[model samples]
Target: MKESSSFGNLWQAPTARRLAHATSQTSPADSHALGRLIGAAWVVVAYAARGVLRGYLGDSMQSGGGVPFWRCAFGVGMQLGVLPALLAALCASKGGGSPLFPTPRRLERWNEAWLRTPSGVWEWAFGYVFGLFFTFDLLLVPMKTNVLAHHVVCLAFHGWVFFSPQRPGLQLVIAGEAVLEFGTGGSNLSMLLPGSDAVRAFFVLAMSASNTYGAVLTVRWLRLQRGRWVWLTLLPTILGILALRQLHVVNEVYKRAHSPAPP
Candidate 1:
């Protein structure tokens, strides 16, 4: 009986302390409720804005030679609308429950091991050298040019992945698009002017990257937390952006393809 009591105390004491610590660290339930309310409100506003833009500008803006109206609108919705909504949802969902944005445990372990590996050091050195070349290209070249902009953005996003709180998995998708764009020579602005191969590749890569990442992040966030309402508000905005950007790329490609070849 004494041995049984000792064993029970040994395990139960730590469990009790952990529970007490968790309760002390946790935010008030009312605060979480208020956060949800605010998040929902932001989603409503985003939805309304999307409707207005689609209804008023989507059709008429198709006449312009630049990016399609719907695509531009969708970008606005995702960057401005959806991002905020996600942030709000995250705030609402924060507490002692299992973290929605829990750090990837295996990734942490891998990173520790990677740091100790010679190959990892070599890879890091290579990345730094390549990064310097890329940075030089950005600084000296006209990034406003269509080709450069695509590449620069890709590089920038890659850099962002290493430091940002964002998930590496998400960054991998974005970086993969950059790889695809690089392969296609999609960064030439002159091509965009004449709708060249580079231009088509740029648009396709950029639009596809954005759409894919936005959807992936949104879905991941929703699955980890009770935020389907927020995702519902965002999915359309992402799809709209993808469609518009795709159309712009196609139109440009068609125009260039049909134009008279150089004499």
Candidate 2:
């Protein structure tokens, strides 16, 4: 009896519990708030970038406060939309028998909760952010300020996947994808203007290599998990990635051939 009591006492110490909790996944509120915080941060970055570029050339972007507002809305949308959808899907796995609120803590030492969370909640969020930022940047390729602002925003979120203390390992696959982006346009978050094409082109080659590396790993992992129906999901993902690549190519070609060289 005393041995068990001592064991329980030792294990349940406040520090021990806190340490354990820290290693666990975050609550939805925490995760979502962090997402919004990151989103808002990019707005500040955009404004700062605007000021910096003003000294160099034409007018900086005048978003009329639209960028920050929309970015915040998107940030909140990320968790609210995804979490409940995941909760519903996960609960339905046993024909609607799973717990309504899955525990954030893990029984094992490694924080692998993201994988089992229904609909790949964390994985999907990370990928969604990646796709969202990539598409955002691609759309703004015509405007240097817009392109630079959102690229910084995207890279900020990209680094979050691995560097964040919570569930760092959860999104290694996404990290792999993001790592590829730096080669392409990641490092050039501020490589604005036409003169950057030659430099950007070289980076693109590196980007392509990283993309291929990540894609191979991503597809294999998806297949291992998604099994036969993987194509339903895999096809769109591959096409989208390829499309982003093409967009980059077109942007570089257009900028180089069409826009005047920077002064």
Candidate 3:
């Protein structure tokens, strides 16, 4: 018992100690700067991805139902940039002494160094997502009410993470939502290159695989007990439902892509 207690103490800082460290470490400005830097990098990557995809995908890219290649590339850039970071963050947390299952302490440990501190992989992941969605919803594409609502919910949640330091695991919740966003990659690509049924089918299959991964993340997220207030959990639940609606649309698109046409 004494040995276990000694190990536990070494394993994690006390809550008061962690709280003091989180508050005293840095200003929100510093955290936002990290986020902004990450956001700006995604913009640069979007431009680069546009050039790369245009080079590789060629004229198949031109039939995007009036959506430009740049817009399509933003989705691609997000997949290229953000998914890896989220996977890395999850791996780091899981490997770095977090329990395999979701406990309150596990949740706290998952965010502590990565996100609760405001300046590491979680910031990188959130900033990249915020940049991609902000650019797509506000700058690159036409505004749809659904997209706007998801964006607002995310922004609200992001605010919660920054302001409500007591709720460190909120970042993990947002990260799960971000995984759901990554599941849209195939739909985005299919919309962008509507003429290529082969490409569309291939990416849709890829999307199914990604959504399966997201589902695993969601299961873990749902098991977490911390930061489970109605206001805290409600918006993200709505966000996931919205994502399910999009998945339905993507399913319809896939069926259309594969269906027989009139003789």
Candidate 4:
């Protein structure tokens, strides 16, 4: 009887040890998934709040009396609020692991390197082009308020996504914004004036460049895990650019619809 009890205990001990090991391995993965969900939820909420504040401030700006300053203030606020969050998320996602926010050390390193690279020059060029297009929207607002609003929204969202860690999400948002504007009679060329084609081309090129950077990084990380190819990261940018072109065509149609009839 004693021998039988000892044998049973011996058999159950290994099973218990295996169960403990399995649980230990899974806990971090579960925690990581939870963290990502929480982070995404926070982002959605933050954006929603930003939209409401933007509308309110825009109304104030339209009323004159130093209202334009408020618009600039809002722009600065958005940079401060969203950019840091994005950087945090990126840092958190390092180490081939899920992060709740950007790692401080990683962000510092990126900032240092980014400041030193020629890529910084291209980024500045894109920023300037975007700013010029934005100023043009202010002049055209009286002719097509909806189109103006669309451009403002697009520019704001693009800035958020460009600086954020979730580049794919930003690409999708920009593509969707393009579609909305195109549907409403906004023309990329008209918005950017003489350099419209060049502006659009630069955005297209930037999209590809950013996607390539993301894909290469993802591939390197996956290789370390001995995982299969994650092709969607590379494919989405192509689809996004196609969507942008389609949006441009739709915007042209809208413009024609609203134009004065032949005398």
Best by TM-score, which number?
3
Q: Local distance difference test, per candidate?
A: 0.41, 0.43, 0.54, 0.37
lDDT of 2: 0.43
Instruction: State the lDDT of candidate 1 residue by residue for 74-170, as single tens digits.
Output: 4444433443333222222221111113244532443343334312221222233334435544553222344355546557745653334423333
Best by lDDT: 3
Clashing pairs for model 1 are 147-187, 147-188
What's the true lDDT of residue 260 in model 4?
Answer: 79
Every candidate's CA RMSD: 19.2, 13.5, 8.0, 19.9
Candidate 2 residue-wise lDDT, 136-254, digit = tens? 54453234554456456556545543344443333334544544544444224214322455565665565566566656545543543423654675556554665676566556556
How much does candidate 1 score in TM-score? 0.32
Any runs in candidate 3 off by more than 4 Å, and if so which?
1-35, 43-69, 82-106, 112-125, 128-132, 195-198, 209-219, 222-236, 239-243, 246-254
Q: Residue-wise lDDT of candidate 4 within 1-263, one digit each (tens)?
A: 11123322332345444533443343434634543454455445545654665565443333211223334333333333433233323222222211112233433444454334312222322333333435433652232454465556556645654554423322123223322322222222233232355544543444334444434433332332221333444235434544555555555446556877768
Q: Which parts of model 2 have CA positions greater than 4 angstroms off?
A: 1-28, 54-112, 115-173, 186-205, 227-229, 236-263
Candidate 3 lDDT by residue in tens digits, 1-263: 11223322333445434533553354656755655676677677666766676576553422433344555656655654566454444334233332223445656555675453555434444655564665454654544466557566656755655555544455455555555555566667667666786767766666665566555555555454354574366646754765665576676676786788858
TM-score of each: 0.32, 0.42, 0.59, 0.25
